[model samples]
Target: MKTIKVSVVTPDGPVYESDVEMISTKAQSGELGILPGHIPMVAPLQIGSVRLKNGGNTEFVAVTGGLLEVRPDQVTILAQAAETAEHIDLERALKAKERAEHRLNEVKQSNVDFKRAELALKRAINRINVQKRDF
Candidate 1:
């Protein structure tokens, strides 16, 4: 079977490195699916799930802001911060969502880390979305 070498990395370190049959992820432009031997491209990724297909299975990794670089032979994801569904805490995600929502509601715009809070909320939601799927 044809396989694409894929890597997911953050400033902290590498999150994943494997040979995937295909990959699907949310990009700023839109959702995209990448298969082996795809045309080279570079795109900004959005806050959502990175789907990896291996054999007949698919895995989900929740990613925050990132950049996806698709090359003829490999694919790389450089995420700001990311987490897998297995590593996520639904309760904690809920709490973060609530906290971000609350802060957005009452905090003064100047003093708030609006972008950070928003990104957190999105990440939490992404976790929920991936966790809900049957894989």
Candidate 2:
């Protein structure tokens, strides 16, 4: 089976690096999937989960937002923030989700950044969902 090197990195450091058979994630245009030997391209990634498949193993990573670069031999995700499902704190994610929900509600009655709150809610939800995946 063919594989391409995949890496996900954030300001803190590289969060994931491995050779994978395929990768799929949300792109600004829409859903994007990359395979080995794919043509070079770049797309803006949104707050969502990145799915990676390698052999029989599959993994998930939650990303706030990022840029996805697909090259002939590899794919690199320059994420603003990222976390593997194994590293995510479920309780914290739940709290964040609740906090974002509250903020969104407050926007109706007080000064609040709706867009920011929405993004936060999406990220939190993404994290929670990724963590919930059964391997």
Model 1, range 20-86, lDDT digits (tens) per residue? 9999998999989999999999999998889999988888888887899999989999998877778
Backbone clashes in model 2, listed as residue pairs: none
Q: In candidate 2, how many clashes are counted?
A: 0
* Backbone atom clashes (below 3 Å) for every candidate: 0, 0
For model 1, state the Cα shift of residue 50 in Å.
0.4
lDDT of 2 by residue, 1-135 (tens): 999999999999999999999998999899888999999999999888899998889999999888999989989999999999999999999999999999999998999999999989998888999999842
Candidate models: Cα lDDT each:
0.86, 0.93
RMSD of 1: 2.3
For candidate 2, the per-residue lDDT at 34 reads: 90
lDDT of model number 2: 0.93
Name the 10 consecutive residues with the lowest summed lDDT in model 1.
Answer: 126-135
**Maximum-lDDT candidate:** 2
Q: State, as a TM-score between 0 and 1, how close model 1 is to the true structure.
A: 0.88
